[model samples]
Target: MSSARWIYLDAGRGLAALVVVHHHLMVFFDHEMAALIGDESLLLRAFRGISEWNVTAILFFFFISGWSIFLAVERLGTLNGIGPWRLYLLQRARRILPMFLLSLLWAGGLSWAGERNFNDTSFDVLVGNLLFLDTPASLRGLWFPPFAGNGPLWTLSNEAWYYISLPVFYWAVYSKIANPLVRIDAALLGSFVVGIAAIGVNAILPNPFFLFATLWPLWIAGYVYGTSFGQTPIERRVIFWLGLMALVTWSMALEIRSDTLRILSDGCILALCVVLLVKIVRWQTQLTRLHYIDGIVRLFGSVGRGSYTIYVLHYPLLLFLASSRTELGGLATSLLGMGMLIAIAPHLETRIYAHVNQWFALDRPRADA
Candidate 1:
C-alpha cells in the first residue's frame, strides 16, 4: 500500500468507527437526544435526516473487509494449497482471539460480579459469542439479549465466517476460474441467488443463522472494491454510483411493501455506498491541494488504527463508566472511552494484532521492502 493512497482508507475506517461511537455516546444524553427531537437548525436537521437513516457505517466496514481480503489475494496470490489456507486462518485467529478473549473475560466477570449470576449464560450462548455465531437478532428470538454483552462483536461472527470462506471464494471467484469476466459473473449471480435464498430463510427463521446468505452481495461488492482499489478510473466509480441509485430507486419504486425485499434493497444500497465512499474519498484526496485536510486525515487515521479494538471494547467500557457514574457523566465518559481506545490501540496493535497479522502475511518478502 502506498501510504498517501491509503491514508484516506485508514482515515475513513477511523471516521466510521467514530460515527458509531458518537451515535452510541448520544444514547447517554437524554437532553441531547431531546434537543435533536426539537432541533430547528437546517444543518442539524439535514444531518439528522441523513444520519438517522444511514446504517452505512458498518456496511462500509464489511466493504473494507472484502477489500482487505483482495489485497491478501494480490500479495499472497490465492490460497492454492492447504498450507497457505492454514496459515491464513491461523493469522486471522491469532489477530482476533487474544484481545477478544480478554474483553470477553472482563465483561463476563463484570456481569457475574454485578449480578451474582454466573449461571445466567449457557454453554451454547457463550460458545456462540466466543465463536461469533450468535447475533442479537438471532438471540432476541431466544430471549437472550444479556448474553450478548458486547453487541458489536456479533458482526465479528460474520467477518470470521467470511474470512474462513474467503479461500473458497478466492478459488471459485478469482483463482481456479482464470477468466476475469466469468469470475465476476459467477460471483454476482451466485451471491445474489444465495442472498435471495437467505432472505427467504430469514423470513421463516431467526436472523443471523443465515446472515451470510443475506449479506453475500455486500461482501462480494467489498471484494470488488478491494480488487479495484487505487486503480485511477472514473468509469468504475460511475458504474458503482449508478448501481447504488438503481437499488435505491427500485426500493422506493416498491415502497417497501415486503420487509425481506426492503432489507435486500437496503443491503444493495449499503454495499454500493461502501464502494462509493472509498472511491470518492480517494479521488478527493488525490485532487485536493489542502495540506490541512491531509493532516486531519492523518490524525483520524491514527485514531482509526485501533478502531477495531475500540469498537470491541467500548461497550463494556461504556457500561462500566455509566454504572460508576463518574463525575464526568455519560457524554464525557463516552468521550473518555474514545481517548482510552486511542491511547491503548498502539500498544495492543504493536504487541498483538499487527504482529500476528504481519506474521501470517502471505507476501511477506514483497511487503517487507
Candidate 2:
C-alpha cells in the first residue's frame, strides 16, 4: 500500500472499472451497434481489440487483488497461530460481506419485483450466492451464469473464496507448522495431491472445482509478486514487457488455434501484469491533479474506488432499462448507470463502509497489527 503502488493499482482499477462498465452497457448495443454502424466503419475497427478484451480486464483486477490481499495478510502480522486467519476473515467479512449481501439483496428484490424472479434459482444456488459460495453444486451451469440479475457478482464470489483461503496458504505454504511431522514441503506435496484429486472430482462435479481449481494459479502469481516485489530486477522486467509486446504484436498477425490464442493471450497478459506490478513503483504526482489527462486518470481512480458498487448496480439497471423502455432503453440505461457510478457511488460506498464496519466493530485495523 505504498503511495506509488496505490496510484498504479488505482489507475489500473479505474481503467478496468471503466472497461467493464462500458462492456456491460455495450452488451445492450452489441447487435445494434454493429448494425447501426456497420462493422466496416473505422471507429468500430479502431476499438475492435479493446472491445473484445473489455471483460479481460477482470484478470487485472485479480492480479491486483492477489497483491493487495498479500499486503493485508502480511500487515496483519505473523501467522503464529490461527489468530491471523481469524483477523483476515473478520476484516474480509467487515469489508466485503455486508456491502455485497446488501447489494445482492437489492438486485434480487428489484429483479423479483420486475418481470424476472428467482423462481428457477434453486435453494442451493440462492444460498450459495447469499453466502458468496457460488461454486456450490447447485450453482453450476453452462459457462457464465444462467441468472441475469447481478450477474457481475461471479467475480466477487470467486474473490471471497480467495480471501478465505489466503491465510491458510500463508500459514501452510510459507511458514513452519507447529508440528514437525508436517513441514512446509509436506504441506505443499499434500496440496499438490489434493489439487489433482480436486481436478479429478471436478471432472465429475465440475462446479466444485471450477473457481478454486482454475483461478488460484492466477491469484497465486499475485502473491508471488507481492512477496518478491524487490527481488525482480528492473532490466528483466523491462525486457519482459518489451518481449511480451513484441510477441503479442507478432502473434496477432498470425491466425492461431483458438485454444492456443486464448492461452497465449491470457497467459501473456497475466504474466505482463506480474512484471509491471513487481517493478519499482514510482509515484505519479500528476495522476492526482485535475488537469485534462491527469484528471482522466483521477476520475478513473475515483470510479475505481467504487467499481464494485457500479458493477452490482449495473445489472439491475440493465434489467430495469430493458423492461421499462424497449425503445432506446439500452442507451438510456447505459448512460444512467455510468452516471450513477460517478454521482452516487462514492457516497454509497462511504455510508455503507461506515455503517457496516461500525455495526460489526470492523472499523479499526486488524487487532493483530
Candidate 3:
C-alpha cells in the first residue's frame, strides 16, 4: 500500500478510537451529563448520535487489523520460512502483551483505590484474560469476562486469535494457489466455510472462541482488499452494490429476533462497510492534493499511532474518575480524561514498547534472520 493510503487508514483508525472513547465516556457519565446539560439539549442529542457509531468503529478496527497483519506478513516474508514465523510471533507479542499486562495492573489499582467491584478481579479471571479467553457475559460460564469490567478488552481476545490464525490460514488456503485471483477467491471461500462451521459448532456447544471463527470473514475481507490494493480502481457501481448490501443487512439486523441471526446480519453490514470505506479512501486520495486536508489527516495519523494505549487505558481511568466523586463538571471530566490519554499514550504505546523491544534485543537483525 502507498504511504498516502496508510495515512488515510491511520486517520480512520484514530477517528474510530476517539469515537469509541467518546461513546464510553458518554455512557459512563450519562447521569452527570444529563444533569449538567439537560437530557433534551441539542448537544446531548448529537452526542448520542455520535456515540451510536461505536460498534461500527470497532468493526473498522478489526478490518484495519487484517489489513495491517497482511502487510506485516508480506513484508517479513513470514509464509516462506520458519524463522520469519518466530520473529512475527515475537513481534506481535511485543506489541500487544506488555501494554495489556500494564492495563490489567492499572485496572486492578483503580479497583483497589475505589473500593468498587467493577467485575471479578480474581486470579483465575486474570489468567483467563491473559490467555485471551475473554468473552461476552452471555458466555460467562464458558469463558472469562474482561478483567475489572474493561469491556473493550474482549476484542483483544478476538484480535489475538486472528493474529494466531493468519499463518495457518495462509498455509491451508494460499499455499497451493499460484494465481493471485484464485488465491483471493480460495481465501474468501475458506473464511466463509470456517465461519459457517464455527456458527454451527457454537450453536451446538456454545464455545466462546467460536465467536472468533464466526467473525473471521470480516478480517479476511480486509486482507483480500489489501492484497488487491492500488490494482483495483474505485468504481461507483462497486460502492453502490456494497452500500445496498450494507443497508439490507442493517435492516435485517434491526428486525431479526434471533440473537445469532442478528449478530450475523450485523457482521455482514460491517464487512460491507469495510469494503465501502476502502473504496471511499481510495477515491479521496485520488483527488487533487489539498494542504489543509493533508494536515488534518497527518494530525489524525499521529493520534492513530497511540490508539492502542488510548484504547486499553481509557476505561480504567474513567472508572476511577467516576468513582472518585470529583468536583469537575462532565465536560471538564471528559476533557481531563482525553488530556491524560494524549499525554500518556505516546509513552506507553510507542516509547515503552520500543524500549522493551530494545531491552530484549527483539528487533536485532539476527533475530529477524
Candidate 4:
C-alpha cells in the first residue's frame, strides 16, 4: 500500500475514535445538553443521530484491528512454533496491557473521588475485567460488567480474544498435519468441542468466549482483505453489490428482535465497511495532491496513533468532570474533556508504551538480530 493510503487509513481510524467520543459526550450529558440547547433544537436532534453511529465506529475499530494484526503477523514471519507465538503474545501484551491497566486505575480513582456507587468495583469484577471476561449481559450468559462503569472495556475483551485467536488460527492452518481431509475433520471437531464448552461455560461461569466467537468472522474478513489487498483487483461493481448487501443486512439488523441475528447483521455491515474503506483509500491515492487535505489527513493520522488511549481513558475523565458539579456548561465540560484526552493520548499511548517496552525489553527483535 502507498504511504498516502496508510495515512488515509489512519485518518479513518481517528475519525471513528472521534465519533465514539462524540457519542459518549452526547449520552453522558444528555439532560444537561437538553437544558442548554432547547429539547426540540435541530442541533440536539443531530447530535442524537450522530450518537447512534457509536456501534458502527466500534465495528470499524474491529475491522482495522484485524487488518493491522494480519500485517503484524506477516511482518513477524511464520509462527511455526511455540517460541514465536509466545513472542507475539508478549508484544501484543506490551502494546495493550499498560494503558489498559492504567485506565482501570483511572476509573477506580474517579469512582472513589466521586463517591459514585453506580459501578461494580468489587474484586471479582476487577479480576474478570483483567481477564477480559467483561461482555454484554444480553449474550445469554454469566457476564462481568465493565469495572467502574468503563463500558468501553467490553470491546477490549473482544479485541484481546481476537489477538489471541489469530496466532492459534495461523498455527492450525499451517500445522504439520499433512492430510487435507484429516485437517478439515480436526478443525471441525475442535470447533464442535469449543462450541459445546462455550455452551457449558455460559451456563456456569462469566463467559466472553461466546461473544468473541460471534464477532470473530468480522476480524477474519478484515484479515482476508488485508492479505488480498494489493494482489486482487476489485471491480467497482463488486463494491456496489457488497454495499447493497450491507444495507439489506443492516435493515434486517434493525427490524429483527433476535440478539444473535442482530449481531450477525452488524458483523456483515462491518465486513462490508472494510471493503469500502479499502476503496476509499485507493480513491484518495488517485486524487491530485491537495496540501490542505494532506495536512488534515496527517493530523488525523496522529490522532489515530493515539486512538487507543482516547478510547480507554475518555470515559473516566468525562465521568469525573461530570461528577465534580462544576459551574461549566455541558458544552464547555465536554470540550474540556475532549481536549484533555487528545492532549494526553499521544503521550500515554506512544511515549509511555515505549518507555514500558524498553524497561521490560519487550521490543520486537531487530531483523539484524
Please provide, for model 4 over 91-179, each residue's C-alpha lDDT reduced to its tens digit, 9 standing for 90 to 100. Answer: 77876787789989999988888845547789999999999989865566546888888888888888888788877776665375665
- N/CA/C clash count, model 2: 0
The Cα error of candidate 4 at residue 330, in Å, is 4.9
For candidate 2, the TM-score is 0.75
Q: What is residue 2's positional error in candidate 1, in angstroms?
A: 5.3
Rank candidates, TM-score, best first.
3, 4, 1, 2
- Top candidate, metric lDDT: 3
Per-candidate TM equals 0.80, 0.75, 0.88, 0.82
- Candidate 4 lDDT trough over 10 residues, lowest sum: 232-241
Q: Candidate 2 clashing pairs? A: none
Model 1 lDDT per residue over 271-305, tens place: 66655665676678678876887788988888677
Candidate 4: regions farther than 4 A off: 2-6, 174-206, 233-256, 280-284, 290-293, 329-331, 364-369
**Which residue pairs collide in model 4, if any?**
none
- Model 2 C-alpha lDDT per residue in residues 227-272, reported as the tens digit of each score: 5554435334433443544365337526533322343347446656
Q: List, in order, the clash count of every candidate structure.
A: 0, 0, 0, 0
